[model samples]
Target chain A: MPDAPDAVEQAVRQVLTSINGDLTPTETMLLGELEALAQEIQRAKREISALSIGDISDSHIPVATDELDAVLAHTAEATNEILDCCEKLENTAPELPEGPAAVVNDAVTRIYEACSFQDITGQRIGKVVTALKAIEARLMRVTDRFGSVSSAPAEPQAPDTRTQGQQLANGPQLPGNASSQAEIDSLLASFD
Target chain B: MDKNTNILIVDDYKTMLRIIRNLLKQLDFNNVDEASDGSEALTKLRAGNFGLVISDWNMVPMTGLDLLKEVRADARLKNLPFIMITAESKTENVVAAKQAGVSNYIVKPFNAETLKEKIEKVMVHA
Candidate 1:
């Protein structure tokens, strides 16, 4: 049986034919694609609306970024405490005999060097936070499509004008691939 | 190099600044000042007599590269020795710093020896 939409399409086609002679193949194909897209959109709306989408974004995702922030703060605090200990040890190391003082100072200096791990870790976590926020933004787009966030204005998407990939930092490289201090020193020397 | 050379260490991270300060102290550089970002460091540089700058690469509002360019552009601070001490150890970043007139570059997790060496190297021609 011909469906109700087919009946309406036939009526519209007849009116267009009477006015403009006949519908073009491209226009007919476009109308068909529009109807199919409308049906797919409705199905997607039902499926997305059925799941508790808000909980994933509002409850779980934001907490992950917050937890990352906490880890950065805690590590920074812990590293500072470690450095403070080194500072105190440094101040007292001069009182010891020369040999032991050398050992103590060396150990303290090594500790101070190791404390920079916190800075690297903090930066890595910051990158993670940025990635998580991007995911949250995509989820918000889905939620908005479902009219769950109808009150908030939709984000304006910039038109893609270029075909080239975005120039951005692809980080956390494996060992031996990234630039080492020696390599960096060599590069700097080339400048002179 | 005189132990009294007034040096500036710039970084947004408080812990890093403290670590660098303590490392400098160990290197016999007792005269040191700190700035959390590049802009503040620029202001301090303009107002004071600073011999060297040890700055981190990453910062908001103004980065170490921005500060370096600004310093190089200014007549008074143009000749001031600048060393970049940063976790940004990329080859391109190093090249950029070199081109921007940075005196020496130190990748992070460095020791007092590295700091002392860079300082001595920069100060020799200062």
Candidate 2:
């Protein structure tokens, strides 16, 4: 039933009485403890967040995948050109000397056999591409769930320069990027 | 088997199709056609008179295995000779292709001789 001003005064008196009017006792201690608990909860939240997969922004994975794709495609194209030239030479090589002609034809056949790298590498690259696609999908889901780690909005991707087949072609890689042909041959032989 | 038998080569990768076609040409088999994937391959198969089907095992939209199943299921095309080319040399994949009625299997990175041998084996029997 008290007026507003009287009500405020009574509330202040009750709070002072709780602290024994010294103003730096029970109430102050309780307020400080509440603040500390709040800070502790905040720290716990941070720890839990750190336990997540962690931020992967600015990662080179995309660039690496793209570069691998480009390199493989280029290798296949170049090899195809070489095979074409070999085929042409085999066709055009004169029949004057049957021995030389046969030798040249055999050499061309060997080169044609070597060009099989395209098909083999293409399959290998297809497997890698499938894996990369799955990873990219999972990464997108993760970003959607946890939000982006970077504050900067992602830069818009430039238009891809690769043509249709070029994008899909994953040709043979050098020994540095993939296992050597000997390793592959051994693995295949094991299957037999 | 006639060297002039109409052949259909299917692969999503253009380079692969080209390589296969070139290999076929080298073998003096000039009647060759191409499709980009299993779906397109099926369309071509249904529309054309192809004697043999050469397909890559992995492709988007539909795989060669799926195409083989479809081909076998279609009564009109059930007896078509199908050759599967794959990079996977796993026993399971080979068995699966066999179970699906694949006429022949060629592992990737194969030479023209390998291709010729498989085609001859399949065509002679087909």
Query: Cα miss at B112, model 2 (Å)?
Result: 2.3
Q: Write the per-residue lDDT of candidate 2 for residues B29-56, one digit (tens) a residue.
A: 9999999888999999999999999998
Off-target runs (Cα >4 Å) in candidate 2 are A1-59, A94-96, A133-192
- Model 2 Cα shift for residue A125 (angstroms): 3.0
If chain B of candidate 1 is superposed on the true chain B, what is its TM-score?
0.97
Q: What are the per-residue Cα lDDT tens digits for candidate 1 across B53-75? A: 99987776678888898999999
True-contact fraction per candidate equals 0.49, 0.19
Local error of candidate 1 at B4, Å?
1.6
